[model samples]
Target: MTRYVALGSSMAAGPGIQPRVAGSPRPAGRSARNYAHLVAAALGLDLVDVTYSGATTAHVLTDTQRGAAPQVDALDGSESLVTVTIGGNDVGYVPMLFAAGLPRPVRRIPLLGSKIRSLVNPAERYVALEEVGAALVEVGRTLRQRAPRATVLFVDYLTLLPPAGPASPLSDHDATLGRHLALELERLTAQAAATTGCGLVRAGAASRDHHGWSPDPWTTRFGWPVPRRPAPLHPNAAGMRAVADLVVAAASG
Candidate 1:
C-alpha cells in the first residue's frame, strides 16, 4: 500500500470522536475516522496521522506537542499523499470563536473564564495573519523538500458559525464578525496553497450551508457538557465523511 501522512490541529485530529485509533498520541485526539483515515482507507494507503487538537503551524513544521514528533517529521520520501489542516489556532480563530459564542455565565466558569477573557478582546480580529501565512508557506516548502514525490494538500478549516444574523449565543455583531474572520482564514488557506503549489480542499466553502446552526450541521454547536463534547464547535462524524470524500475526489482528480 502507498504511504499517506495527515497533519493538522483539532480540526483534523477530531477530538471527542468515537473509537479513537490505538497507538495514536491520545493527547492529540487522533480519530480512527478522521478524513485522513477515511482517505487512506478509500485509497488503500498506509496512514501516519499526527494531527494534534491544539496544533498551530509551528507544531506542523518544527514544534512537538505532548511528546509527539513534529508532524512533518513523520514524512519520508516514500509517502504518496499528505494532507494538512491547520492555522486556525495560530490566529486564535477557534479559541476566540468559542469565547464569542458562549453565554456570559459559561464564559465566567473558572476553567473557561480566564481563557475566554484572554482572547475575547484582542487588538485585532484575527491575530498574526501574516506570520501564520508565512508559516503555512514554509510548511508547504518543507513538506515538498521532505517528501518530494508526495502530493501535498492543504485542507481549510470547516465552517463553524451561521452565515449572518444572530444565531443562539452569538450576538448579531459577533455573528457578522465571525463570518469576516472565517473568510479571512479561508482566504489565507487558499493563498498558502497557491503560493506553495499545494492542492487545496475547500472544506470551509463546502460547509457554508452546514454551519452548526444549519438544518443539517456538519459541525457541533457550542455546548458546555459535564464531560465536555468530543469536538465542540468543530466538525462532526458526518463532516469527517464529507471531508474524506472531498479528499478522495481531490486526490483522484
Candidate 2:
C-alpha cells in the first residue's frame, strides 16, 4: 500500500465537519470530508491524515503536543504523496482575526485595543512573516530529506476575505488587517514552495472568486450560522471540493 500523508493546521484538519476520525485520544478535530480525504479517495490512496487544529510549524517538525507525533515523523520516505497546509498559525493569523472580531465592549477596553493594534501593526505582522518564512524553509528541507520520492505539495491557505478590502461586518481596522494578511500569507507560501522545489497548489487563487465576500462565498464568516455547524473563517464544503480538485491534479500529474 502506498503511504499518502496529510499534514498541517485546522485548514488541513477540516474542523466542524463530520464523520470525524474516531478512536483518537487527542481532540484532533479532523474531518473525513477534508480535502485530504477527498483527494485520497479521488486518487484511490489510503490517507494517513495527521493534521490537527491549531498546529504550528514547530508542531510539524517536532512534537509540540503530547499524544501526537511530529507531522514529519509520519513520513517514512515511502510516501507516494504528501500534502501540507500550514504557516498561517505560525504568524498568529487566526488569533488576529478573532481579536479583530471581538465585541464592542471588549474593544472598548484600552489594554485590549492596544493589544489588538499590536497584532494589526505592520511591523509585528512582518516579523511573523519572517518567522513563518524561515520555518517554511526548514519544513521544505526536512520533507525533501525524509520523503524524497513523495510528491510533496504545499497547499496554500484558502481566501478568507476580499481582494480589494474587507467587506462589511468587519470593522475598518479589522478589514484592513484581514486583507493585508490574506495576500501576505499566499506570497510567503509561494516563496517557500519555490525555495523547496515542492509543487505549489494555488488554492488561494482558486478560492479568490469563492471568497467569503463573493456572491457565492466558499468560506464562512464571523457570526453566520450554517445549518448544524458553524465553521467560521474556514472553508465550506464547496471550497474543500475545489481545493481537492487542485490537489488531485497535482498528485496525479
Candidate 3:
C-alpha cells in the first residue's frame, strides 16, 4: 500500500468522534473516523496520522505540543501523500469562540479564566495573516523535502459559521468577526498551497453553505453536547466524511 501521512490540528483530529485510533495519544484526540482515516480507507493507503487537538501553525511546523514532537517530524521521505489542516488555533478561532460562550463573571476567575478572557478581549491582537501563510508555505516545502514522492495538500478548516445569519450562542458581533476570520484563513491557506505548488482540498470553500446553522450542518455549533448537539465548535461526522471526499478528489486529480 502507498504510504500517506496526515498532519494538523483538531479540525483534522476530529475530537469526540467515536472509536479513537488505537495507541494514538488521547491528548491529541486522534479519532479513528477522522477525514485522514476515511481518505486512507477510500484510497487504500497506509496512513500515518499525527494530527492533534489545539494545534497551532507552530505545532505543525516546529513546536512540540503536549510532549509530542512537532507534527512534521512524522514524515520520513517514503510517503506518497500528505494532508494538512491547521491555522485555526493560531488565528484564535476556537479560543475566541470558547471565550465568547463563557459567562462574563466566569471569565473573571483565576488561571484558565484569565486565559479565556484574554482570547476575547477586543484589545488583544490576533496572529497576522502573512505569518500564518508563510508558516504554511514552509510546512508544504518542508513536507516536500521530507517526502519528495508525496503529494502534499493543505486542507483548510471546514466552515464554522453561516455566510449570513444570526449564529446563535455567539453574539451578532462575534458571529460577524468569526465569519471574517474564517474567510481570511481560507484565503491565505489557498495562497500558501499555491506558493508551495501543493494541491489544495477546498473543504472551507465547499462547506460554506453547510455551516453549523445550515439545514445540513457540516460543523457543530457552540453548545452543550446533547444527543442533538454536536461537539461545540468543531466538525461533525458528516463534515469529516465530506472532507474525506474532498481530499480524495484533490489527491486523485
Number of the top-ranking candidate, with lDDT as the measure: 3
Q: Report the candidate with higher lDDT, 1 versus 3.
A: 3
Q: Candidate 3: global Cα-lDDT? A: 0.85
Whichever of 2 and 3 has more lDDT, that candidate is 3
lDDT of 3 at 224: 68
**Candidate 2 lDDT over residue span 112-230, tens digit each:** 88887776666887788878888987887788889999899999988888777656667787777777777888888889889999988999988887887788887877764354363
- TM-scores of the candidates in the order shown: 0.92, 0.91, 0.92
* Arranged by lDDT, best first: 3, 1, 2
Q: What lDDT does each candidate get?
A: 0.84, 0.82, 0.85
Error of 3 at 64 (Å): 1.9
Give the TM-score (vs. native) of candidate 2. 0.91
Provide the lowest-lDDT 10-residue window in model 3: 121-130
User: For model 1, what is the C-alpha lDDT against the true structure?
Assistant: 0.84
Clashing pairs in 2: none
> Model 2, which residues run further than 4 Å from truth?
108-117, 224-230
Worst 10 contiguous positions by lDDT, candidate 1: 222-231
Q: In model 3, which runs have C-alpha deviations exceeding 4 angstroms?
A: 110-114, 122-125, 128-130, 225-230
